[model samples]
Each structure stands twice: as structure tokens, then as C-alpha cells.
Target: MPVYKDKNGTWYVMTRCDDWQGQRKQKCKRGFKTKREAQDWECRFLLQQGGDLDMLFKDFYKLYEQDMKARLKQNTWEHKACVIKSKILPYFGEKSMKDIQARDVLTWQNELLRHRDKHGKPYSETYLKNLHNQLSCIFNHAVRYYDLSTNPTAKAGSIGVKNAKEMNFWTKDEYMQFSEVMMDKPISFYAFEMLYWCGIRLGELLALTTADFDFKNRKLRINKSYQRLKGQDVITEPKTKKSNRTIEMPDFLCEEMQEYFSMLYDQKPDERIFPISKSYLHHEMDRGVKATGLKRIRIHDLRHSHVSLLIELSFSAVAIADRVGHESIEITYRYAHLFPSKQAEMANRLGELKKGGGF
Candidate 1:
């Protein structure tokens, strides 16, 4: 009833529906080459209009993307979109949303676990977890919106591959040694110094501008972050609400920043403090690591090192979380083991108290 032939012999599907406000409206799609295609399109369109479960995953994904565009940040949307297009769609694109069962999802998860990239290495657990999360999100969205009766991901337990590799971080002595080698490269030295001492994320560090700093008050504001997604540089809000915070810089670091500012010709308020790309930063870090003959770690380890140092100095978890713009103290607790053990000192004090007969 909804299919018709166009003037150029192509077929079209048109459906009339009542809008949310009760007004009648027509939804039409053209350029179908066959009557069957037109009828299929009409069927799906009508089902979608009636909020029935009749669309394929690929079709539902289009609607999901439109819903997400208004709710998610640019970087998050882009990441999810990339995952869906590259990983999820290839396997489940044509499958009906209602027909994708737990077993099917489990099979896909196993395939992902066994999948090897060009490097012949299986995807990291964190990456696998992210991919699983994206899949779960799509299914959950479908269930919540009544497009599907159940979420297959709910029963597809633990799709993420748990790798036991320990996270890498540097101690104070190692960082000091690395800094000694970085001294010759002024930009790298300053950048690493801020990263280590401030404990800001790489994106937050890259987003820094002259106006964000207050040398007189020894404070720095973190309100935004910079990221490269889909080969484009994007500036967006900080990762979380708590990430938008003010940090009081140490006196020595404040002085170093002042000296660094003096050498820069462009001192405009909006001028970027560190106008370097991620690749350049990695290059300098690699050179410094090799020259210092220290344990190689990612640039992000500098943030971990900063937290370790603060914990060593007896800073509370809340204090460290505030300084580093962590969403919660529980995140800081992840580095609890890195804190220097005070057990020996506590035992020594107890011995002294016993010797003095003070209980």
C-alpha cells in the first residue's frame, strides 16, 4: 500500500503517520530500484514509526547515532562511532535487533579475543573492554527505547580479556634521573616537569594557555582538554566535572614557569603554553628515556609518578585527588600500594614507647 513507481521508473515508498503532536505527516524515501525494495523500506519505516521491533542492527545504529549526537561529547561520540563502524557492524550489521541472542554475542566476543591486528598481537584488555562497552551500550539503548525486548549483552558475561600485566610507573629517583637527561631539551624538560609535578592528564596539559595560569597566586586552572580524533584536533570540556579545578603550583615549579614564559615571544593571554603535538612529546620522552638509561615508560606514567610522590610525602587521598582533578578519591586509591610503607616507622615508635614504659 505504500509502494509506488516514480516518473523515471524508479520505485518509492511513502508512509503517512500521526506526529507526536497529533498532526498527520508523510515520510517518504525514494530511489529504490525494485518494488520489493520499496515495500521492505515501507515495512521497516512503518514498524519504526509504530515503535515496533523490526529493524536490523545497521538501521538501528543510524537512529542510535542521531540520539547520541545530542547527548555525548564530540570525542566520546567519535570514539563510539569508530568502534561501531570498525568492529561491531561488520559482524552484526544485517542481523535483526531482536534476533541477536546471548550466544551470538558470546561468539563475537570470542572472535574479538582471538583477533590479531597487523602487529600479530591480540587487542589489549582495556581496548577489548572499551569495545564490549560500546556493544553493550547499543544493545542497552535498544532495550530502553523499546526497539528490542531484551539486551543480549546482559547475559554475555565478561567479554573483556583480563590481562595480568602490571601498570608501569616511575619512582622519584627514576624521574629525577630522567629529568637530568631532559635538561638539554628545554621544551621537553618544562613539559615533562609540569606533567610530573601537576599530575594533569596529557589532554589537559596540551589544552593549557597563558591565561589559565596565575603566576602571582601560584595557581593553574584546568577547564578544558585537547584531543585528536579522526585526524582532527578537538578542544572540549574536561573529562569530568571534578576535572575542572584549580591547582596551587609549588614555588619552584612556579618560578620555572615564569622563566619559561619570559623566553616565549608570544605572551598573549590566549597563546598556548605548550604548542607541541603528541608525536613531538613522545619523541622527546623517548630520547630522554634512552639517554638516561632508565626503565622505559609511557609519557602518561608521569602522572602516576606525581601521585606516587604525593603519597610518599603523606598527602591524603582527597588532597591528591583534588590536586590531580580526579573524579573521586577512590581513583587515587589505585596508587595506594605505591605509597612508601610506614610500617617500619610505626613499629620503631611502638618499641620506643615500650622501652619508655608508656604502655
Candidate 2:
């Protein structure tokens, strides 16, 4: 490596490389402000010849984003970029990829663990795990493609857990109480009905249009999901292939929606059934919960409440999974853990089976 300075007070670096025809070539890059900048450029130039691992983490992350951004949905990529820019980059942006060790990763994890927000709140365990996974993923990419020794995160181990908290949901009676409170507003009532009865995601529910409902057959077709991203409303494919499904509507719900539709003046079939923002739905929930004095739950908990209702009705995992568009029956079975009160009921049924000489 050779760095030189001229009377003009600028620094430059030169390097030798082999040309295509087996000829020696001298490449010079100039106009860096400081000798450190010149040496840094020279170091990167030599390391480009050595391996990709010596590049700064930020530079490698750009490569990572280039390779990955096109493969993900816009909203998904936005979330990853936000996390990387906000949480991961500040600690390791300028560090060389190959120089980050398990201890360095551990140090970063401790700092994140102790981090507090403006409201004096720490990141959720799941969020901590998400950040760690993002950092670990970068290293994993290097190991798989750049011939790095190992993923330091694999050695450091992962923080947080997959299911950080138990499911929060309402029973049929509890939901009925809340639903009664929402009945004063027809839109709120019908929206909660769909969420509790169909077990669809908020995006899927918001994406529903008048044309999607077949009142004659009491069925609802779900194909697209709605997202409010970057200050625009976006309609994208459902969360999974299985999420593109048809749900059978309850007779009462079908009747209720029919009445609700009748109230709309000159609404088109293509228009959203509920042209309301998520904030509106949330506010309605707060109002309903406050009016009914019921246990407070998130809008998503309505979906869980639906699944639990199915479990209580003795529905099979496969049936529940199909109804909810779960990717696998195993996912539906995860809700089984939420219903521990069923243990005594199971024992009682087994006792009856023993008395009847049945296994």
C-alpha cells in the first residue's frame, strides 16, 4: 500500500493489479482529504483482492439489501430496513465485517437489553430477538457466500423467544357482551362479527369488498390484503397461499351484512365494505370495551378469540386451520395451549370412556 500527499494538500493512493492480458497495471485514486482516508481506500482496494469480508458492515449491508430487497414485499422490506437503520447500523456500521466477534455481538446485545425509549420503556423480548436475528442474518449471509469462519451469533446464542406472551382473546359470552355494545354502530358491529366469526387478519378484513360476498350462498371470498404503507393504501396478495380462501358466513351475519349494505347509498360492489382506517377500528374497540366494561384486547385478539371458539366447539385442528387459513394444522394446535381449563374436561371424558369399556 502506498499513500502520498502533494503540495495541494490532498491525499492519494495507488495500487498494482494484473491486467486481463497478464500485464501489470497501476491504478491511482486521488483527492481524499486525509492520509487516513487515503489509507482506508488503499486498504479496501487490497481487501477487494483478498475477500469481501473486510468490507465495512454498512457496505456489505448494501449488498445484502440489493440481493434481498427485490425478493420481499414492499411493506416487509420497509420494516427490515427500518430496523437495520435504527437499531443495528449505529453499533456496527463502520466496523469491518470480519472484525466483529462473538464478544462484540454480545456487547451489542447488552446495550440493546439496557436501551430505553423516550417513554422509559425497553424493547419487547420479541423485538430484541428480531434485532438479534437481523444482525445474525447478515453474518449468516457472509458465512454462506463470503467464506466467513462462523456465525458469531450462533455461538452467542439468540435472545428472547418465539411466543413471548400467551394469546389474548375473549370467550363467546364475553364477545357477545362487547358485540352488543358495538351494535349501536352498524359498521362496527358487522366488522367485529367478521373478525370473530371468520378469524381473518385485519388486512384481510379491510380488503373485503361488496363483490367478495355471496349472500345467496352465504360465502365470503378472500384474496387480497390491505396495507397502509408510506402514506398510501396498498392492496397486496394475502399473507400466505392458504390465506386465499373462502369462508362460510353464519346466517345471522349474512342477514346483518345484507341490512348494512342496504343502508349504503349507491355503493359499488368494488368499493371497500369498510372504508375505515385501522385507527378508526381501534377507537371503536376502545369505545366498545369501555361501554361494556369487558377485558381489553387488541383487534388481532378477535381472530384468536375465533380460533378458541372453534377449539371449544370440539373442532379438529385441520378444520380450524382451514377455516382460519393457517399455513399448517400445527399452528392451530398452538391455540390448544391457551385453553388449559380443558384438562379437567378431558379427564372426565376419559373416565366415561373407561366405564363404557372404550379406549
Candidate 3:
């Protein structure tokens, strides 16, 4: 470790580490305001070079972020990076990975629990859980690759939950009332129509182009998704492997979409049919909800609304899951309550079988 004061009175550090070829190389960092700061940086640098758990938490997180950024979708990775930077970095940035204890994690969690937003509401359980998971993942990476005894987060226990308890959706009749008013705006109307009738995710809906629609076959293809990131509109592959699917569009919906396309002026086959920003859709939703006086639900709830409709029409879980591009188990589990109980029907069928002596 070599700590030196530069000409301008700022401190700097020169450290030595082995490169990939196993040759010793000198690394230099500047701009430390104090001698202690330079010494701390050198210590962390040496520990990191030693490939052990003694590196600073913030330093290890940088490596973890580099690994994840390459692995995740741009939109998904941005959200994860934002959460980790905003919430987890503040408390642990200067702390050492080797010194963090279970009690320290508990204290951080308690502070999070006591925090309130501008709305005076504490963070939602799902949000809290995600934050904790992000923190735990940092330590888990260290345990797997770096020499670490145990994850303090495992001993601290996680806060919040994996999923929210409340689920919301509109009945078919309610959607009818809403769509009735929505017809005044063709774009809004057609968008909601597709969401409710086709059961596609919003991103999938936005990424649609003229080529995706096969009017002759009455089919709509979903192979990509849209995301608005950092003031730029980005198109990426769909959320999951199952998300790339083809759906049979109802004739009425096909007609409505054709009419909507006619409203556009020379839009290219590759151009998005719905070119508006997501905020525009949210604003339209606000107007519709206010005018219809219907209970408010998120745009995503339109997906749930579709699932609920499928259940009511007596579609099996597998059929509904295939249509919605979700795993059958997720459909059966998330909407389990909405699925009708068949205990009585099973008993009656069994009784009929007994009478027929068809064992």
C-alpha cells in the first residue's frame, strides 16, 4: 500500500495487483480528500485483488451489477439497478462485506418499515420484499464466488412478501360499460378491446406492427415487446419463451383493428400501430374511469380481467394459460379462487357412474 499527497494537497493511492497473466501491475487512483480516504481505498483495492470477502460492499456490488447487466433485458436490468442504487447502496456503500452482521440487516429493515412516502404510506410489502431480495443477492454472490462464512440476510430473515395479497379485475359487464364510452376515441377503444379480448400484455400490444396481423387468416402474432427507457422507445423480445405466440383474433376485433389501421396515414409495416406513449394510455384510462364511475384498476388488471372472463366461460386452466402465454401452473395458482370449485360436480358425476355400473 502506497498513500501519497499530490501537489494540489489532495491524496492518492498506488496499489499493486496481479493481472490475468499472473504478472504484478501497479494501479493508481486519485482525488481522495484525506490521507485516511486514500488508505481505505488502497485497503479495499488490495482486499478485492486478494479475492476474499474483506472488500467493501459497494465495491462487490459493482461486480455483481456488471454480471447482471449483461444477463438481463435492458428494461428489466434498469429497474433492478435503480432499486439497488437508490435503496441498498446508501446504508451499505461504505460498510465492509466481512463486517456486516444479521443485526445490522435487521436495523436497516426496520428503518425501511418506518419510512413513509409522499402519500404517507409505508412502502408496499412487494416493494419491501424486492429490496431485501436485491440486498440478499449481493451477499449470495459473495458466498458463491468469494470466501464468505454465511449470508447475514439469511439469518436476518426477509421482510415483506413475494406477492401482494389483493388481486383486482373487472367483470365482463363492467368492461362493456367502460368500453362503450371508450369508443369515442378509436385508439383507446381498440387498445382496451385488444387487451380485454386478446389477453395480451401491454408491452406486447404496443410492439405490434402491421405485419404481425394476418387479416386473411384472422390471426395476430406476438413475438416482441415494447419498452420506453430513458426517453427512448425500445423493442425487445417478449417476456418469456412462451410469450412468442399466435392468437386467433375475434372477427369483431379484426374489423375494429382494420378500421383503426385505416385511420393511420402511410404507416410502414414495421412501425408500431400504437405509437403513443404509455402516459397517453394512462390519461385515457383516467378519463374513462372518471366518466364511467367504475372502480379503478390498473392497465395490467385488463389482463386479469381477461383471465376472469375465460374462467367464467368455462375454459380449462391449460386452455386459458395457452391463450394468455402464461405457464398453466401460474394460471391455476394465481387465479385459483376465481376458478369454480368442482366438488359437487365431481360427486354427481361419480354417482352417475355408479348407477351405470361402469367401473
Candidate 4:
């Protein structure tokens, strides 16, 4: 009854609906090519207005976005929104929530795994997992709030496979070799030194200001991180509660930072220590790699290198976790392989006890 034909030969649906406060409002949707399509839309719209379980995924996503805006950080909300827009919405936007099935989700996930980026590289396992999680979050929200029958994503299983390539990191000697190249670029030298010694994330490093450094106490406080989203730079709180920590700097590094700060005359406390963009940092690292003739590794690998060094120094996992801002020692267990020597030493001590006939 709400379907009508427009003068431009398009079909439309017009209806009156009650808003949240029970106030009457007019709702109209146009541009359907056929009367049947317009009628179908009107039926769905009426059902939705009547508080029934009939709503398009695209429409549901709008509600989801509003819910997430208050519950999630801006950067996290932006990431989930991007995944919905670029991946989830393209496939499910027009489908009703009740119409989506586990099979459809599984098929879509497989397609995502098979797809390649513009550079012809497949999406990383971590990235695929993030996408899967975002999809799951949306469906879970729908099931809980909108009374949807089930979450298809719940039955879709894991979307990303574990990465096959071995994790790459540098040894102290290799890092020293790289440092030789960094010496010529003072800023880069300081940056890499901090990254290696402090084991801070690149975002945390970039967000640093003079106020964060306590040269007198040889300590650095990490409370914020820098992120680039939608072509704008954003400063946000640390990723986790444990990420907000203070790290002690070695005496030599403290002396170096003192000299570096002196070079920046008339600098404000709030101004970023490293004001350059991430792309510029990458360029400098690439140049350093070429100059040093070292095997290439990402900027993030500097943190791994620091962890390996700490493991080699016989530091406890708990101590390392606290120093590196890991939420727990379980997170630090990923570097267990680097401490194989400790395991072997324990085995040797057990053998000695066995020989001595002690329990």
C-alpha cells in the first residue's frame, strides 16, 4: 500500500513511522526500478518500524556504528568501520540480518584469504584475523541487541591461517652493524637507539615529548601514542593499561639524550621529540639497510631485537614483560625460543641431580 510510481519511471515506498519517543515521522525510500522491489522494501521497512527482525545489514551497521562510537576508542572504531565499509558491507549490505548464514560467512572468508593487495601480496594472517574479529563483533552486537537469531560469524571458524614465515629479529652484533649506518643521521641514530633500548612501539616513540623524558632521573614515561588515520595525525592513549609505564634509560643513553635536547634550542615541552612522519622514518631505515648491507627488517623488529637481548641477558619473563609494557608474561612467551639456552641449562642441572641421587 506504501508503494508508488514516480514521474521519472522509478518506484518508491513512502510510509509514516513512530520515532524512539513515539512521535510520528515520515519515511521515504526511492529509486527502485520495479513495483515488486518497492513493495518488498516497504514490507521490510514496515516490519522494522514495528520492531520486527527485518533490517538490511547496511542499515544495521549504522546502528552498530552509533553503539560503537561511545564504547570504543576513536581509532578502534575507525578500523572496524573501515573493515565494514571495505569488506563486510560490500558483501552483506543488502542482505537481511536473518538471511545471512554460516555458509555465506565461510565462503566470504575464503575469498578474503584468496584475495591479494594492490602490490600482489596476500593479506597478512594478523590482518585477516582482525577483519574476522570485526565481522564477529558486528554480528554479536546484532544478536544481543537486535534479537537476531544467530551470529553467522560464530560458526564461520577461524579466518586467518598462522603465518608460515619465521619471525625476524636482529642479534646485538647485527644491531651494532646497523647502528654504524645510523651514526651519520643523528635523528635516526637516536630514534633506533631508543627503539632498541627502550622496547617501545613506534607510535609511542613518535608521540614522545620533552615532558615525557626525566633526564635527571634517567627515566622515560610512556602514556600516549601517535596514529595516522584518514590522512590526519591523532594522539591517543596507550594501547593497554600496562602500556602506560615508565622505563629507565642507561646512563650512556641518558647522556646522549641530554646532548640531543640541548641541540633543540627554545623547544616547548609539548612538542614531539621526533616530529617527522612514519614514511620519512621508513625511508631513512631503508637507506640505513642499504648502507649497512644488513638483512632487511621492519622498524617493528627493533622491539623484537630488544626482547631477544633481554632474554639473552637472563632476564625473567615477568621483568621483561613489565619493561616492554606487555600486558602479561604469557604475551612475552612468544620469545621463549630465544631463551633455549636457559632450558638446556635447566636440563643439565636436572641431570646432575639425577647423578647425585637427589629427589
**TM per prediction:** 0.87, 0.82, 0.92, 0.86
Scanning candidate 3 in windows of ten residues, the lowest lDDT window is: 45-54
Tens digits of per-residue lDDT, candidate 1, 33-102, equal 9999999888777766666666778888887887787898898888789899999999999888888999
1-359, model 4: which lDDT tens digit per residue?
A: 65889999999888898888989999889999999999987887676665455788877787777677888777888877888899889998988878999998999898988998789999888788878888889889888888888899888787774443456888989998888888887788888889988899999999999999998898999999998988888999998888999999999989988878887868899989888778888898899889888888888888888988898898888888899899545545577677655578889999999999998
Candidate 2 ranges with C-alpha deviation above 4 Å: 1-51, 118-120, 339-359
- The 0-to-1 C-alpha lDDT of every candidate, in the order given, reads 0.84, 0.87, 0.91, 0.85
Q: Which ranking of candidates, highest lDDT first?
A: 3, 2, 4, 1
- How do the residues 325-350 of candidate 2 rate in per-residue lDDT, one tens digit apiece? 88555555577575446678998999
Which of the two, 2 or 3, has more lDDT?
3
Model 4, C-alpha of 123: deviation from truth (Å): 2.7
Ranking by TM-score: 3, 1, 4, 2
Off by over 4 Å in 3: 16-26, 349-359
Best by lDDT: 3
lDDT of 4: 0.85
| Residue 209 miss distance in model 3 (angstroms) | 1.2
All-Cα superposition RMSD per candidate: 3.4, 4.9, 2.3, 3.3
Q: Look at candidate 1 and tell me the lDDT of residue 296.
A: 81
